[model samples]
Target: MNKQVMCEQCHKKVASAWVTKIEGSEVTKFSLCEDCLKAFSLKISINSQNLPLDSYFNCLNDKEFYPERLSNFKMCPKCQLSFADFMQTGLLGCPNCYQFFGQQLRPLLEEMHGSLEYKGKIPVWAPVTYVLNTELKALKNELFSLISQENYEAAALIRDKINTVKEKLTKA
Candidate 1:
């Protein structure tokens, strides 16, 4: 027999959607019913076009979850693409749109990719030091965020990991 999972949000309905967030060594998982998932998706589609998922979920119970309007009037100088156009099509006009709309794109990119920094596979030919440095950089960023959140235990663990990576870099 299969066990059904209840929605974490509504608690009254069986969950149809699951969401997971990973931060450093920490992981968080939650489930949502079909109705609640649809409502949340609709809110993202209709209300906050570029809002971060974290902010939206954090303010789910708030009456004023929507923030001030983004620059609708702003346009990319290279492709003449407006933020509204990008919102509608979900595509940037050109490479220059990255720089032109960087401020507006940051949250959306973070929401979609989890981080502004690219974490794709490194080339096999890449130097060991390069790889170790990249790992150290990411660990340091996580360490800072953990410190800000006052999770000293986790921060200490990350610090040790960072030091280990640094030692590897020195050896390389």
Candidate 2:
């Protein structure tokens, strides 16, 4: 947890010398957190108040029963994510659960169109990937619904199957 670093400019003892990505290697730049970072001229912004460009902010606190704090949501009571908002915009507040929430996102995609995939990993409409994705979407929706309905057995089975598919996806 504890790390020791020196400032690049003054060689002074620093605690968090930033990770400066160089041409090849990720060189740690020993610089003043503020001044050193500016000196490096890396594309970074500090104290950035600009909202997420995904437009998720508009619906941030729109949900009537949303928890006041992130501790409330299973992920974070303060998650404050709006399923309705995500459905309308097809965007997310943060990319945090964008992957993990795939199952939950399926219904929205279905309502929007007959398909769940907005974009493809391989190509616009690769038949194999499309088939596999359709299967994955069905399983994901089933898992989410089962869990919500308290059908533990079905949910567990679907969960295992999803894990298998996820593993295959990772390899691919």
- RMSD vs true structure, all candidates: 23.0, 18.1
Tens digits of per-residue lDDT for model 2, 50-131: 3342233234446653544322232311243445555456667666646545667666568767687565345546666566
Candidate 2 wrong stretches, greater than 4 Å: 1-126
Q: How many residue pairs in model 1 have overlapping backbones?
A: 0
Q: Estimate each model's TM-score.
A: 0.32, 0.26
Error of 2 at 171 (Å): 2.4
Model 1 per-residue lDDT at 3: 54
Query: Candidate 1 on 47-89: residue-level lDDT in tens?
Result: 6376655455567536464433436546576666778888999
Looking at candidate 2, what is the lDDT of residue 16?
A: 31
Query: What pairs collide in candidate 2?
Result: 8-30, 69-77, 69-78, 70-76, 70-77, 70-78, 71-77, 72-77, 73-77
The lowest-lDDT stretch of 10 consecutive residues in candidate 2 is 69-78
